[model samples]
Target chain A: MKGKIRSMAYAARHDGLHAIRPPLMKRIADASAPYLYSAPALILIVAVMLVPLVLGVSYAFRDIQLLNPFSGAFVGLDHFRALSEDQAFFRALRNTLWWTGASVLLQFTFGLILALLLDKPFSGRAIAQALVFLPWAVPSFLAGLNWAWLFNPVVGPLPHWLYRLGLMSQPANILSDPQLAMWGPIVANIWWGIPFFAITLLAALQAIPRDLYEAASIDGAGPVQRFLSITLPFLAPTIAITILLRTVWISNFADLIIVMTNGGPADRTQIVASYIFTQAFKRLDFGYASAIALVLLALLLAYSLLIVILRQWLLSKD
Target chain B: MRAKSTFLTIAHRLAILAYIAFALFPLFWLLKVAVTPNDLLYTEGVRLWPSRASFEHFDFVLRHSSFPVFFRNSLIVSGSTAVIVTVLSSLSGYALSRFRFRGKYWLVTLMLLTQMFPLVMLVAPIFKILSPMGLTNSLTGLVIVYTAFNVPFATFLMQSFFDGIPKDLEEAAMIDGATQFVAFRQIILPLTLPGIAATLGFVFTAAWSELLFSLMLISGNEQATFPVGLLSFVSKFSVDFGQMMAAGVLALIPACLFFLFIQRYLVQGLTAGAVKG
Candidate 1:
């Protein structure tokens, strides 16, 4: 970063704006190269995404319903007021916590194990790695549908198998049972998401110096001791960053819940993300939806800040 | 110690096999159901393989369903989005990699900020904005939205690739009587062919999987992408497990094919974007 800055100032002094010998046309062309390269992408993002995001934030302070033609009224805090008392929204918030917590925890644990397993130089490990990572390629909606089918009693084997194993009293669709509905999507998410953690953690694991482990072993360190003293410390930054980012990312991920349950069976699967979809699309209440989204955005930012502070604190302790 | 090491090796292999089975089982079920004739779908429901399997479901979906249309629409949308995003991101990513220009910091920050926020927030507003311009309920609209959504991460992915190549290659070309732009085009972009392919495949899969906006923006059956089409078919038809599973398998084909091709570089791509969900 400092090198880039130094070069910028150097170019400015020697060959850029301060130089007098260069022709006007040549200088202009030289200065505008990066702009010309980047303008197309920047303009599209501004027009499509960034502009809409600002508008969406503004929508939180107004009354905007899709079907109601005369509904663009300025209603300050009315949406937020309604959101505070909405039991369903509160329920969705709690569900978001449960969903993000369980999904990240399980995905990380299994992913670390999978990475550790693959780290060894074993025969046919390449094919094994590919096969195990295949689930991450399955689109989120299909993952939901596939798992939802598995939970269905008639066509799927899961319910019957669980029944045979005496885990369930009968073959049933857990998706329609409010108490157990969230697990349906949560399980699908774990299946789809495990590969992500595995791939990334594997990359980090491979980058760890092999000699460090050799040295630790030669120093009479056992497997668990070496893992704690070497692997854990080596992998800590990657683990922290991945965990923090995945938390926010998964909380915003609503496709599995939306496809599987649509927040049904008494809204058991209604996280804030799917709730935003439900409000904006189903109810056509853009205002309320944007308000909920604003709250979610704030929460995610706060969470990210918290993680950054926690990371800094841990680093300072060492 | 030898006996314990031998047991650990067996356990490790068993664990790998177990994970592979768990990963492939759901996909296997999708294929199994797709090939199973409707009559035996329920009778052989819990069986690992259907007693009688046929391509009747795929046949019916291809010959006599709206799926062909959905498949074509998905191809067009995802393909266009991927190509367009690759082109745009390549340019921006090149700038990010090679330049020390003004406002570069802000530009990078803007792109990163876009990656972090909830895109569901933009649904209603984008609809409102696009509808007035008559872009809603159109494939062109879907393509534009998808292209924009993908460009930021694709840019980062492309930038990482550019970063890997030494700047001296382009500089050497520039000093040998070639302009910087010409050198970048003739000498540098060719070397990043693998990165470009990886970016294209990555963006294509992302555009293919998008659901919410497509559902919202494209209201009619004619413009529906695969996700919207398959979803509506599921809700409307309600019980054609054979056909739905067949279509699901078809939807899986393109993404998985591209996935297999680019699986090796996923560490780079995911690290760049921090894993888009």
Candidate 2:
């Protein structure tokens, strides 16, 4: 009887071990599964983006002009030195700031109003929402071209309308006038971009709890007062993040400038991004273009870091 | 209070109308010019509607020009990029949503960093890299580049979608003897079809609009995407305003269709993300 009980206990222990081993193996497989899933995307990103980024940085210090067969020599910051003196480069830097600032400000302001307007329930809200958001669907290149045509004196009505409104002396294309040329792209950028802000801000606005608004109204808060206290605070974080991301995005956005002006009518509308393109494509000077790109990259990185640190400081204070 | 509220309501309606008009006016003008006969295009300056409209420009663009080829190329590239990015992003996004692995934070950071930098920086290097491998001027090259560029955002979007799904559904599947991969593929994926559709639409529109790399990489007219072809046509035949506008309208069709399909989901998806964050 003693021997039989001992054998029975051993047999149970053996069965428990068998059950535990498969699960241990399964856990190991499970733990590594996420990495396995992510590996393909990570590999592609590294191969296509990260490797090229590193190579692009290296190209900044070398001469890698596209057309010139003999131009693959290490130049050691020669492109940078020349960039420091290029008047066009300085002008482009200024234009970039102007373009990004104006575009962001207008898009955000109009977008906020639109978002607030749409936030309220009304008849035909669905159709109104779809129609208003259509521009975001238009391809940026096409938007650029379409707007360019609109501003054209020959084929478009904008110039004619402006002349009628006494906004201009004649129905001349503002795109050709160096003085007001940058506004052409800036306006187009705003028209193409407002829907983005509207969509994002509208989403954020909707997420604001309904009870908060009810409570505020119960406390005798008027529309303006409620907007000032409740709406503003709720929209602040979205506004900050959207503005930050858009600043970086718009500064690099060259499609409108390229399509509208080709950085032309005497380089007046040439932001740094278009300038980089002109160097690489028109001049075939990849080395110089990469150099300009590097500086732009560094400035953007600094800007992003500054925003992050500022946010952290504010958070800590609160 | 009654008077003020009524006034506010009127103001709101008018405001919404104004916004809609501002948005649609440009597109309407594009269509207006596209349908205007060649003879009427210049004569009817500033006319809201032309005296007579014709499809002559559209007919000419479809039969006479290389636009058909360009359209086909764009469809191929954008369609492939959308499908491939959705698949890859679904996997990576699943990893992000479900896993607590090492380097996950860094991976997210890397993806965001890609979005913040000027893509023009990579233009030269990509050309150099791809040219050596004979990938430039090829549709394959464009697809690869666009897929990489779009995956980051699509992944984030997909992750939000995945987060909305319950973990128990997959857990129960696992408990029923299905592998996790099978569960993800057969169970969770079908439930997230709307999210998948949204991702597909977003990536499709992005790839469709990409101009610079396509312009740089494709030197041959044979492989030119819609943007490149339209641009080249504009520059070469600057006098054909009607044809160019017609072609522009054609280009707008697919993107608009995709947009209409996804617009309803846009706010919902973003709200999901905003709430989670």
Candidate 3:
């Protein structure tokens, strides 16, 4: 009788174990399948981006002399000290701010204007749209070079014509003038940036329901009144997002300065990017350059995160 | 009702025509300079067309100088970087768009953060890392650097494209005895041709015109890209406008041909499935 009872208990235990095992195995398989999908991309991104970032941050804190890189000493805030006090770095900071602020505002305005103009039905719309978008399609370095050539004092067609036509007393080397040099890059950047805004805003414009406009028209609203009541409100989110993103990008408009000015006329047009280049490559002071980079990075991070947060809030409200 | 709007329509068309002329004038001048004889470049001054036109500058830039070498180098670098970045970004972007993962948020944030830094900052550490690998002063080095810098934004671009695609088609493919990767290649990639074209165009143009890394990495004329080559036109005292503009015009051809080839897909790609993602 005791042997039979013990055998029954053993059989129950084995059945229970078998029943639990399949679900456990299945759960493991299910959870891991998604992970398997994501693992490759995650690994590549980390290898290319995350590792370098962490290394950059760590290197920023260390006092790394090129001559004695192996003997890096941990000097807290020394690099930061050097950057904040540097006159050239400060000029770059100021210039970058102006570049970002002016470019973002004007680009948005022109983009919206162009998008609105294109929104209406017209002949040759496709070709006109393409022509406008051409600047953005070209790489910015090429555009900068083209603009530099256009503004060349002696040989360039634009200035030469102006000089011969007596529009100016002297050949206006726009780049040579401290006041006008920065404008060359500004124009180049604005040209490249406007199309992105135009495309995004145009996409948003197309989404607005026709019924809204119809109803407004029935209420005796003019075209301008309808645009104010209907178009502006609908475009606000896209405009905001576009501005935020553009600000983030235009801040790094270093390539323009590099190709055009090389921060010329005594660092007058130097922005954070060119300044960082000058510090790192020309000066060979990696630590100090890295510090300025950190500051620039911090500015970008704050704006980007703010945008993200704002977007989330807007979405949640929707 | 239709007649009243006809006058307005004609005026609008005329306005657009004017705008088109304004946009294209610069490109016309690039060609104008390319063909203008060197003697006529300055002597004719502001004249729209020179009395004489020749291919002397073009011939000189192409034959007597390093322009062809620069062009070839640019082609190799831009072509390789575009292909490499597009392939990588497509796969990674697909993963990001479709799969829910443990670290997706942080991974994306980190990629954005990488873009946030002025690339000038990364140039030092990049040089440090690539120096040991002997990647500096080579086409491979430029390709690698361009690929690294471009991937994040390319990934974002491609992810947006992938997101625009319907997931049901892929799911149906999976149900019909296809693996995920196979489905991606056979079904999804065909639909992504426009996206692929846009990505290729963007990356190609970017790497083609990049000057900073080229200026830094390459020291010799043989390895120089076009932008750097254009700089050689500038000696200490005088700038060679004819040769430089001639070179610039030649550079514009590949880029123009590239844009012409991709422009159709680029337009469709930008406006594709707007109401969706």
Candidate 4:
């Protein structure tokens, strides 16, 4: 009887342990499930973006050139040294500020106006919204080409109209003149980018509680007053974030300038992003290009940090 | 007060009209020039309507140019990238939406960081890495690069869609002995078809419009996507405005179609993103 009881107890204990093991294993599996789901994307992003990013940063310090086979030696800070003396790099930097500033400011201003105009209900609003937003759907490259064609005096009417309005001495292509060349791409950038701002702003605009507007109006708030009291405050966060993101994005946008001008007319339109492309593609100097890119990356980070700090300060002040 | 309101209304309509005109005029000119006969192109001198419109340019572009090959290549790259990105992002997005994990915050931050950095920084490095792997100058290379670049935004987009779905449906399926993945597939995935379609369309247009990577990765005419091909065509035949515009119109077709497909969802998607953001 003692042996029998002892054996039964042992069996029960073993079975209990066995039961406990499965849940532990199951717990681990459950814990890892999210990671498993995200693993593929994470791996791809790491391999394709992160690894290349690190390698690119390393290239900033190394002598790496595409066409030159013997250019793999590590030359610390040599590219940066060269970049310090590159006048064109400085010019491109300034132009980037101009391009980004003008593009973002104009896009945001117009986008806000367009969003407000579209906010009210009207007949044919849906079709009007779609039509106005159609430009966003046009591929950026095609937008570039279309605008380039529009600015061409030979086949386009813009130059002739400008001359007729006395905005130009003659119907010469603005793209070919160094003084006016940057505007060609800037105009194209504005035209292509406005819809992006409009779409996002309109979304934010729609999210404002209808009751808020009604309340303001009931309080004898005129349109401008209501807009100031309610709409601006609601739109502020969206505006700040969008502008911050878009400033970085448009500064890096080299497509329009590249397609339209190739950064020519004495390189008047060559922003840093396009300059990086020109260096890598035209010069085959990957190291130098990477260096310029690193500087740009640093500047952008600093700008972002400043914005964050400013935002925190404002919040604290409030 | 009524007179003031009336004037305001008129001004609003006029302003909207002006914006519509500004937005459409460039695209309108593209279409206008595409159909204008070569004989009348310059001679028409910016006439609102051509004296005579012809499909001669389109006919030549379709029959003679290498645009057809570029179009096919672009279709293959973009279609494959869109499918792959949507599938992968759906999984990751689902994880992000449903699961509270240790690294979730960091993952989101990492994805946002990817958006901020200048992609041009990666151009040379990516080229160097791909060239030796025999992936350079191939459509597969373009697909891979484009897929990586687009997945981050698409993931956020898909995550928003997933958030819109109620958890009860999937939970019920799970209680019925279906695994989470199985529930996601069987119950939740079907309901998110609109979101999937929107993501697909968005990624497709993005991949189709990509210029920099395609230009860098693909060299030969056989592998050249539309943007690169169109650019090369421009350089080679700079004087062929009619033909180029016709090709431009051709390129616009798929994008516009995709736009129309996703137009209804665009505002909703942006709103969801903005709210979450």
Q: Could you tell me which 10 consecutive residues in candidate 2 chain B have the lowest summed lDDT?
A: B268-277
Interface RMSD of each: 1.3, 2.6, 3.7, 2.3
lDDT of 1 at B16: 94
When summed lDDT is taken over every stretch of 10 residues in candidate 4 chain B, the lowest stretch is: B268-277
Lowest lDDT block of 10, candidate 3 chain B: B268-277
Ranking by lDDT: 1, 2, 4, 3
Whole-model lDDT per candidate: 0.90, 0.90, 0.74, 0.89
By summed lDDT, which 10 consecutive residues of candidate 4 chain A come out lowest?
A306-315
lDDT value, residue B11 of candidate 2: 94
Model 4 accuracy (lDDT, Cα): 0.89
Give the CA lDDT, 0 to 100, for residue B68 in model 4.
96
Cα lDDT tens digits, model 2, A119-165, are 99998999999999999889999999999999998988999999999
lDDT score of residue A311 within candidate 2: 49
Candidate 3: tens digits of C-alpha lDDT, residues A1-318: 999989999999888878998997777765565556545545655655566566667668887656665746777898888776788888888888888888888888877877887888877788798887666655556677777877786556767766778976788887888877788788777766777777788878988998999999999999899999999999988777667666776787687887788887787889988887877667776677777788888877777778667755865897
TM-score of each: 0.94, 0.93, 0.87, 0.94
Clashes of each: 0, 0, 0, 0
Q: Give lDDT tens digits, candidate 4, residues A1-318.
A: 999999999999888878898897889989999999889888889989999999999999999988889888999998898999999999999999999999999999999999999999999999999999888788889999999999999888899999999998899999999988999999988888787889999988999999998888888998889988899999998798778878988999998998999998898999999999988887889999999999999998877666545545644775
Better of 3 and 4 by lDDT: 4
Off by over 4 Å in 2: A1-27, A306-318, B268-277
Q: After superposition, how far is residue A30 of candidate 4 from its true place, in Å?
A: 0.8
For candidate 3, the TM-score of chain A alone versus the native chain A is: 0.89
- Please, what are the lDDT tens digits per residue for candidate 3 over residues B96-120? 8888877677766666666555666
Residue B236 lDDT (model 4): 95
Instruction: Compute the lDDT for candidate 3.
Output: 0.74
